[model samples]
Each structure stands twice: as C-alpha cells, then as structure tokens.
Target chain A: MMRAFFRVAWIVVKKDLTIEVRSLEILSTTIFFAVTVVLMFSFGLVVDGRPLNDVAAAILWVAIAFSGTLALGRTFERERHNDTLRALLLAPADRPALYVGKLAGILLLLALVELVLVPLVGLLFAAPIFVHGFHLVALLAGGTIGFTAVGTLFAAMLVRARSRDVLLPIMLYPMTVPVMIAGVRGTAALFQPTPDLAVAQFWIGLLGFFDVVFVTLALWTFDPVMTD
Target chain B: MHSDFETLAVIDVARHYGRRKALSHVNFTCAAGDIIGLLGPNGAGKSTLLNILATLLAASRGRVEYGGRTAEQAGADIRGRIGMLGHDLFLYPELTARENLVFFAQLYGLSGAHARVQAALDRAGLGDRADDFMSGFSRGMRQRVALERALLHAPRLLLLDEPFTGLDQASTKALVDRLRECQQAGCIVVLATHDLDIVDGVLSRAVFLQNGRQVGEPGPGTALRERYRQAMTT
Candidate 1:
C-alpha cells in the first residue's frame, strides 16, 4: 500500500514537471509575481531594523502562500479546460489515490518555488532568515504541505467555476489562517536562534497536524468535487 | 479477468439529478462474456446507467451485483476489477504516452506495471508512439492512447461511453477488432454509442433506453434497433 501511494504520487509529480518544462509559463509567471510582491514590500516597509525583523517572516510566508495558491488553482484549471481531468477520473484507480497524487504534485511545485523565493525575500527585506538555514526549510515545508493539501481540494472545485481565479484565494485564505499563523510563528523562532525549541516545535507540530487532517479530508472529498 | 460473469446483474436501479429523473428503475443483466451495448438518445440516461455500474456514480435507488456480491458491499473489490472509458481522453498533454500509461498503472496497483502498460500500448496499436507527446497527437491517436490506458490494468469488465467518437473508418474498425479480442479474452464489454452502423454486428445484445426506461427485452440483431427507432419516434 505504501509503495502504491508513492508510485502514484511520483507519477503525478512527473506529469506536472513535464508540463512546466514545456510551457515554462506558469513557473516564470509565478516567480515574477513573487518578485514583484517582494519589491512592493520593500518599497512599502522603508527598511527600518526593528519593524523589518519583526514582521519579515509573516510577509514572506503570506506572499508565498497566496502566489502558490494561484499556481495550484491553475493546475486543475488547465486540466479541466482541456477535459484532461475527466479522463483521469475514468482511470481504474482508487479515487483517494488520485487525490494523493494531485496533492503531491501541487506540494512539489510549491516547494520548488519557495526554495527560490526564501533567500530572495530575505535579501530584499535584509532579514536573517537564511541564518538558521535547514530548520527554516523544514518549517516552510511543514506549512506548505498543509497549505497545498487544502488548496488542491478547493482548486478542483473552483476549476469549473466561472470566477475561479478570484474565488480560489477567497475560499482558501480564511481556512488557512491557522497554517499561516503557525508558519510565521515557527519561522520567526527558527530565525532568532532561541534556546527554547518548544514553541517552534509546537507551531510546526500544529502545522503538521493540520497537514494530516486536511489531507485526510481532501482525499475523502476530492472524488465528489472532481466529478462535479 | 473473470471468464464467468453470468452472475453480474443490475437490479431495478434508478437515478435522479435534482428534479430531473435520469434513470428510472433500470433492470439489466449481462451473462459471462456478453458484449452489451447501451443505446439511447441524449438525456436518455444511458451514460447515467453505465456510470452507476462503473461505480463512478451512485444510483438513487436499487442495487448492482457482480457474482452475487453487491456493488455497494464490494465497492473496492468491484472497482479494482473494472475499467472505464468516458468522453474525455484524459491523457496529460505534456506527458509522453508511456508516462501516462505508467501513471494509471500505478493507480491500478498492477504488478509489473511497466510491462502491462507496454502490452496495453501494443494492444491499442500505440506501441510505436509510446514516447511521443500526447498533446501533438491526432484525435484518433489520443483515443487509442486512452484505450490503452483503460486496458492497462486487465479489467474484467470494460465500460466505454461513446468510444467511437473521434475515430476514422479504419480506426473504428481497429477498435472493433480490439473489442473482439477483449471479448474472446473473457472481458465483459459494455458501451453506449449513437453510431448504429457499428452496432449491427458488434454487440452481443443492444438495449434501447427511451426516456430513462428500458422499453423491452434486449437481444441480438435488427430487432433491438427497430424497437429503439420506434420508441424514440413515439
């Protein structure tokens, strides 16, 4: 069962990567959007030391989360527009396995985008995020897993809706507040090099829990949503 | 693949979408190795009945049984043994034909998935195009790929909705030939199609569904078509 899960997961990731390589549109556009958001933040914040350090994690994650949602929303939108997702639904696999495959695809893309954005944002804001390095990456991954799981489920619904581009963030943001809060709070802890790992671990664990809960819910619900 | 599916039965199944009744008290049976053709006009619930049997949709009322096992109780087991091909080709446009098949093979949890996909490709006459990108393929070529994907898991029952849609005369002949091979291999094939020309000899039995009801007993030959024509005209 475990082998089956990862095999399906890997195939979905490969399919998304194949498309990304050919088009080169969604990836570049997402990165450009992220850079533009970073530049806007720089212009608005004025680069003062204390205020910059305090909210830097919040700005970084929020920007990544919203932009990542756009990329994911477009994932199924592209498939549905071309009627590709419908074909997939006809395949003789367990529906929940397909849900896992889709979640992995979106999560993989979000992770790849964030790897580039993290340091660029740190440089833009003159914050010390990269100082802790690996720990910060783990925190980012934890938050992203939860976000992508929920985001993919909602995106499948919005794919067929007329106002999907506008509806995705509106539907996803309110539900992901807990994830956003935990992401920022955990990242902030990692950056500061505090003696207490408890608080950071607590937030990261909360994000992890959210990941598990939403992933289960999404698997249970994705078939009905995808069919619609 | 089961050689004996005489026990597969659909009992008084009905389905509704909001206020509109799609399928009403549908009763049908397919004995082992039977190639059943479900024929009806648009909104006649041919697709709805097949979708319910494929376990993709639930019947509002009634039951389906395969080998005396209720589809509801045997949902997972039944799904594992069945393959479905709907209107959408469903291939990832960017992935090579090989990638697409392997992806579905993994989903079906097939052992030696790579080899099964290769065999399915050969069955669909797509072996030469295994590495080609599906996005650039012709409509007939894409449908072939979809057929290969559907056949990859060696399903005992095949549910194809309008499988002849984008095919040329030659391609359609090839598909019929492949259907014959599947029938010989003991796979129960069920399809819903508007193309009566192809159904004349291809179906073991053709069922006429008019306004969501099966008009009479389905049987072989021109009688099924006559009943279908009369029911639809009336």
Candidate 2:
C-alpha cells in the first residue's frame, strides 16, 4: 500500500512535469504574473530611494499569495477542462496520494517562480533577502507547503464547481489565512534591519505546524471531497 | 487479486440528483466475455448507469458488485480492474499518444510498459502520427487513442459510455473489432451508445432504458435496432 502510494505520487508529479515542460503554460504564466505583481508593488511601495520599512516583506508575500492563487487555479483548470481529474480519480491509486502529488508539483512550480521573484524583490525593494538566506528558505518552504496543501485541496474541490474562477480565491484566501499570516510575519522578521532570526524561526516553526495540520486535513478530506 | 471477478452485478441500483432521479432500480449481471449494451435516448440515464458501474459516481441507492463483492466492500483497488471511456476522453492534448498511454500504463504499474504502450499505439492506428501531440489529431483519431488509453491497463471490466460517438465508418468498425478482442480476452465490455445499429450484432445482451427505468427485458439476438425502437416507443 505504501509502495502504491509513493508510486502514484511520483507518477502524478512526473505527468504534471512532463506536461508543464512541454506547454510552459503554468510555469511561464505563473512567473510572469509573480514578477508583474512585484513590479506593481514596487511602483506603489518604493519611496525616494528605497522601499518603506517592512513593506518589502509585505509586497513579496502578497505577490506570492496572489500569483500562487493563480498558479493553483490554472494548474487544476488544466485537469478540469479535460476532465482528466476523473481519470485520475478512477485510477487504482489512493486519493490522498493524488493530493500529495499535485501539492508537490505546485510547490515546485512556485519555488521556481520565487527564485526569480525573490531576487527581483530584493533588487527593487532593497530587502536583503539573501542576508538570512537559510532561515528565509526555511520560512518560504514552510509557508508554501502550508499554502499549497490547502490550495491543492480547494482547487481540486472547486474543479467541478461552476464559476470556479470566482470561487477559488473566495474559498482559498480564507482557509489559508494562517499560511499567509505566518509567511508574511516570518519574512518580515527576516527582512527587517539586523534580521531577527529568532522571531523568523518562531514564525517558520508555526508555519511548519500549520503545514502538518493542513496536509493532514487535506489528505483526510481529499477522497470524500473529490467524490461525487 | 482484483482481476479474478467474473461477474459485474448491478443490484437495484439508483442514482438521484436532488429531486431528479437519473437511474432507478436498475439491475443487470454481466459475466466475463459478455458485451452488455445500454441503449437509450438523450436523457435516458445511459451515461449515469455507466458512471455508476465505473464507480466514478456512487449509486444513491443499492449497489454495484464485481463478482460477489460490492464496490465499497471490495475497496478502491477494485478500480484497478475497471476501465472506462466516456464523453470526456480524459487524454491530455499536449501529450503524444505514446506519452499518454505510457503515463496511464505506468500508473497502472504495468510491467513492460514500453511494449504495452507500443501495442496500444498500434491499436490506435496513429502509425507515424503517434509522436505528434494529440491536440493536432482529428476527432476520430483522438477517439481511437482514448479507447486505447482506457484499455491500456487490461481492465477486467471495460465500461464505455457512447463508445461509438464521433467515429468514422472505418474507425467504428475498428472499434467493434477491438470490442470483440476484449470479449475474446474474457473481459466484460459494457457499452452505452445510441448507435444501436453498429452494436446490434456484437452485443451479448441488450437493456433498453427510458427515464431511468428498464423498458424491456435484456436478451441477445438479431435486429437490436428494431427491438430498441419498439422498446423506447412502448
């Protein structure tokens, strides 16, 4: 059973990657959107010679949140249009395995987007992102896992709903408040002058706790929510 | 362990959508090698029945059984032995035919996936076109690929909803021939289709449905189109 679960998760990730690599639909669009959001923020948030205090972290997290929402919706939208989710659901694999696999794929896609967006944010806002690099990475990982874990569940749940485009953010943003708050607060700590590593670590730890709880809830709920 | 089921039994199965009943008290039994045809009109619940059998949608009442065990009792692994091709073909358009089949084959954990995928590709009859993305294929070609995709796992119960839709004559003939091949392999093939004439000679048994209820007793014989016409009219 464990073998089947991992096998299914790995194959789903492979399938997602192959399709994404060929089309460049999700990765390219997501990165473009993230960068655009950051640029938009740079316009509003930057002052005489620098971004306002603590605004850099807020802008970065906001860009990640908004663009990550788009990425999650678009990812499942591909499956929805083709009704391929039905095929996946009809597979012999476990439902939670499918959820975990999709979450992994979305995380990878967002990680790539952030690779560009984070540096761009640092360059524009002068946020010193690489100063507390390892803590920042840990924080981002914890926050993203929490965010996409819930996002994956909701995106999949809404795949069959009419007006899913309208519903995704409405359903997503609320359920992911903990993720968003932790991500922003942790990154704020990291971005502050003379970074508060302890505070950032605390928020990162809180994000990790949320990740565990959110993933467990998602895996537990995925099978029933996906079923008609 | 999942493939050993010889019979798929629908026992008093019914599915409802709010107040609308899509299928009601439907019953049938299909043993391995039997080609069961579900013939019906536009709103007659043919797809609903097929979906129920595929276990994609649960019946609101009663149950579906593979061999002697119900779907819930048999567990999800029972789905490993069930394959379906429906109105939605479930193929990723960006992927090549080989890629799609290989994906499904690997998901099924089929040993020798390369050979299996090649065989499926040949069955799809794409030949030189197999390497191209399916987004470029015509509807008939896509249908063929989807059929092969569904069959790649060598499922014990092959459920098809409107399997003949959008096929040219040659492709339709090819599809019927493949159904025979599945029957020969001792697989239970259930077809829900409006092409009663096309499936007339191939069906091991025919069940006519109207407004979610069976109209007549199912039997295997000639002149199925005429029989279906009378069943629906009456």
Question: DockQ of candidates 1 onward, in order?
Answer: 0.43, 0.76
Q: What are the models' TM-scores?
A: 0.87, 0.96
Residue A61: error of model 2 in Å? 1.3
Worst 10 residues of 1 chain A by lDDT: A46-55
Count clashing residue pairs per candidate. 2, 0
Docking class of 2: medium
Kept native contacts, as fractions per model, are 0.45, 0.81
The true-versus-predicted C-alpha distance at residue A221 of model 1, in Å, is: 4.5
* Model 2 CA deviation exceeding 4 Å by range: B218-222
Residue-level lDDT tens digits of model 2 in A148-202? 9999999998998898889988988898888888888889998988888889989
In candidate 1, residue A70 scores what lDDT? Answer: 73
lDDT of 1 by residue, B151-192 (tens): 777677888989999799999998898888888888889999
- Look at candidate 2 and tell me the lDDT of residue A220: 94
Q: What local distance difference test score does each model get?
A: 0.77, 0.88
Q: Candidate 2: which pairs clash?
A: none
lDDT of 2: 0.88
